[model samples]
Target chain A: MENGYKLSYLDNLESESIHVMREVFAEFEKPVLLYSIGKDSSVLLRLAQKAFYPGKIPFPLMHIDTSYKFVEMIDFRDKIPAKENVNLIVHKNDKYIKKRMHPSKFGMDKCCKFLKTKSLLDGLSSGGFDAALGGARREEERSRAKERIFSFRDQFGAWDPKNQRPELWSIYNARINPNESVRIFPLSNWTELDIWHYIKKENIEIVPLYFAKKRKIIRRDGLILLADQFNSPKEGEEVEEAMVRFRTLGCSPCSGAVESEADTLDKIIEEVMIAMNSERENRAIDYETDGSMEEKKKQGYF
Target chain B: MHKEKDLLRLVTAGSIDDGKSTLIGRLLYESKGIYKDQLTSIEDIAKKKGEKEIDLSLLVDGLKSEREQGITIDVAYRYFSTQKRKFIIADSPGHVQYTRNMVTAASTADLAVIIIDARKGVLEQTKRHSFIATLLDIPHILVLVNKMDLVGYSEDVYEKIKEDYLQFASRLPTHDIQIKPISALRGDMVVKKGNNMNWYDGRTFLHYLESVNIVSDRNLIDFRFPVQTVIRPNLDFRGYAGRIESGVIKVGDDIAVLPSGKKSRIKSIETYDRKLDKAFTPQSVVLTLENHIDISRGDMLIRQRNVPEIRDELEAEVCWMAEEPMEEGGEYLIKHTTNTVPVILKELRYKIDINTLHREEKKELGLNDIGRVIIKAQKPIFFDPYVRNHKTGSFIIIDELTNATVGAGIIWYPSATLPETENSQ
Candidate 1:
């Protein structure tokens, strides 16, 4: 994608991301890229490969699995590490899983705490990772729009939005104690459309679930949820089939797919251009309450 | 896809009451960046707050304290785009204590729009922001004379404000200044030409933002590439990975590694997906050399004859960032490009007053204090004068104990060295 004479827009984005990766590598000792096996996560993985060039990504990538991700995504995650030659680690809250804790039983908010956020907290604490690169982009959500590239977290892994340090220019303040972890967003400035464009241009492989397919979906709590183990039809509820694709990926229960026929990258780009709804609109967690994303961010949710 | 290189990074500077947030809200609304669902959410929030008008203060100010207090506390980055260009605004607070945040937001901005109330004319905060924008070397400045409605859309008020701001800006080192009249509340001359400001024939603020020519500001003659990491994906290739801070590099051309001064010929230019024939400023690439001499991070690659100043000691204008006042002989970590060196602040020359532009003798600099200080790095670090290049010239000082970034330094002058290149702009 790089042209010697003129830098393509994608090239510019890639260079900026690579610079961020190098900064994280230079600054922190135990840094991990939080791989969710989504399109954005795929872009980050490849960027890390290109960032270090001959050297492998110095730190391992960890996925705080809630054990409720799409089957295709889990398969891709398991198979791609060897091909890419990047170290990958997966951690799930086995305690919560063993206790049969479900979002339906313990409320969606509390369920997320035990399944995703608490598991991530446990992973970082055990791994001793001082810094973790998140795949969050500013254009996704409102609270994300205000985030710094190198976002600072306190000793308890809590984000103080008001007390965040000022990041001037490319100079990031990675200065923190050993116990305090820094959440870095190398893709902070990238938009959702930018991610799709880079994916198609680089020919990077992502899960085929992003493309439109006929899936059994049910309407629950004003959300289109996939009919999976975590989300089955309630009594008297009907399961509907439709050609849908996920704009943003997460656990199957919370992630909603849009009714899109965009089976290819070009079609998706065209569909996204004319669409009025943002990708963040598809996430179930963001709609729990007003400023829910900000509320979750304060409690150390990515 | 239309490969348009029209991304504009800008900063908005003004006091809290000058409708800074309102102007940003207008820009977002006008650009259609605020989607239908988001607008609905904002309306819902506004209704809950019992606000008759849409309060944009909720949009930019995400922190609970800021929203309750109705003031911005930290720098928040907001992104919006027009058909022509993508815009990222580092929206920093205008509080005096948060001057450090202003400097941070303005550091990487190509342009700055410092709003001044048309009714109040140019104030002290206006002058302070203008000075900081100038000191940061922002290529473009727009003295946004907002609230034209309050002045009855008079031609004289706009003219007087422009004259006063220009007179104040004259003392500072800022050029390429543009002024526009607008009313963020009534929406005059923000995105389109409002009927009220018939006297103002110039482009709207958004139009000006889309068309500002920043191409000529970058140094393209002298090539400077600071190596960040070496890319040796396998034994078959040895690529010097780095972002080209300035100028162009081509294949088969002779280049020299800085500090070591080792000369080699370019074998190939490696990019992520393919090989590049040539590369220019700000494009990160992996370059392979013919000889494959020892090259790693912290070493720079430039055109054979043209090189930057290599000095162990430098005098710079540093904006103190930490709460602790800068100690004269304290050892700190200095990060410039891909290099980090232990350095000591030898002396504090003086501090500059943004209000008066006076050189006041100061013992130490605390938070948000702008001062000139002499620093001695443990080893020779390569740099350019801040006036010429920002990437090669700028650096940050880190407190060793706290590991906090204590100061931001811009090299004012390099030590006595040979001016080898006559192609200086």
Candidate 2:
């Protein structure tokens, strides 16, 4: 759309994200895309494909699997590498996983730190990546509001809350020390509803579990958990099949499902428009304590 | 007049107690952007603390340090949308020390809402933010004479402040300036017109934001497409990829590559998905040339006749953010477009005395210092004057030793002298 024809909001967001990804490609070497295989990550991947259209993504797409994710997410992740020419690398903290690390055994924060933060750090350093492209959006949390488009990390990959570089216009300063890595957020400006609208517009395929489906679920701590090989009912805890869909996808142990019959894209968008709660409310890790996300971010949590 | 409204990036710059955060919080609240649980939690916390007001500022200042310090340290962003448009608000810190933060937020803003408390009319902070917003070439500015309730909702106070601001703003380079009185705390003249302001007539802030003419704001001429990367996914196709900075290009158009001065014809315009009849400004697209010309990331493809200025050295007004002062002969990396080349601070022509709005001789610039300097680059770069097209004209200076972004500079073409490259000394 040009001249008098207005470009849609989603188009603007897509262009902005593509520009960010292009900067990473042009400015830095050894940059990696932190793929979470969620809707946001899928959108990020599609944008990367667009940024390097007709060309394979120059860098690898790394996923730090906690091994507690929904099976559909894993299946989707596995199917992507074969269909696309993208360099996909799946890394896990083998040492920690061998210990059978669970949110039940440790806490949500502790498990996430080890399985996600520590594993991601190990994976990134091992790959020698100088910058990482993530899918975090500013509208997700209050603490996330202070994030820069190109967030700088110290030698320890810790995000300093107070001393952040001033990012101006499209001219992103991608320079960082060799020991430091920049966490680049391409979707920092997008809202949750915008993501849903984009997903509908682009017809971007996501995990089928996002749509309402009948599955065995157990309610505990005000959250609906998928009763599967990874998650099961406790003694005297009731397990029942319920119609539900995930507002967000994370480790099965901590992620929660919301009650909805919004199976189609239009239905999901409609639901999101009228939904009264923030999407992060369904995220159990955020409710661990006050300032949990910020605390985690300071300690290098993505 | 367009069928759809695009994204609107706005920045709210105000002094302390101007209720900028409350204004943003009210906008989000009115737009149904805030969640039920989030509001309840804030309310619960407020009650527990025995607070009278909800402290809407807490919603905007999210950083732990920011909350602890009771001030915003960096540019905090919030997104809210109406049916017409989506908005991203960069709530900049209000303190005078955060000029860099305000400038950083204003760079990419299509519009800036300069909040002024009605009680304190035209203060130092207002002038500073207004000057910074204008200097950065933000197209539209809406001066919200906020907290009118504190001034008894008097039209006289609003008129007086508006007149004072207009007189001050006349000295600066501003495209469009509109001033209105608002009580952000009481939900007056924000999303809807308040009942108290019976004498005043103007579009509410949200209505103006939703219906503002933004499509015409973009530069649709002088095509400047900096090649970001060479897209060679496979052996079959090879395309040059970048987001179009300005103008429009279609298939079979003749173009020239800058720096290399290579000529080529656009065989097709690929938008990463499908080939299009034409592409306009700001669309990220890939293009294949008729011939295999040597093009890299730093190269730009422009219309043969309509091209940006190519220069090796230029004048610029820089905002230094580094803790250390700028050196006269310092070598730093100048990143313009997709090009990054070594540049030297050849001369410190003069620094702007922000308080007086006058150019004063300064040997060096420290943190939060804005000064005009002469930068000599290792090679020529294709750029435009920051006044013409900000996307192609602005750049950042990186410290070679620290790899930190030391300063932000706008490409300047001095009026009194010839181009810096043609000068002998």
Best by the lDDT measure: 2
For A37-94, candidate 1 gives per-residue lDDT tens digits of 9999999999998888656888899988898888888989999778898889999999
Worst 10 residues of 1 chain A by lDDT: A1-10
TM-score of each: 0.94, 0.96
Clashes of each: 3, 1
The best candidate by TM-score is 2
C-alpha lDDT (0 to 100) for residue B49 of candidate 1: 82
lDDT of 1 by residue, B172-281 (tens): 76478999999999999888787998877899888888788766777787798887777665888787777888888889999999889999999988865677788787
Candidate lDDT values, in order: 0.83, 0.86
Q: Which docking category, incorrect, acceptable, medium or high, applies to candidate 2?
A: medium
In DockQ, how does model 1 score against the reference complex?
Answer: 0.51
In Å, residue A212's CA in model 1 sits off its true spot by: 3.3
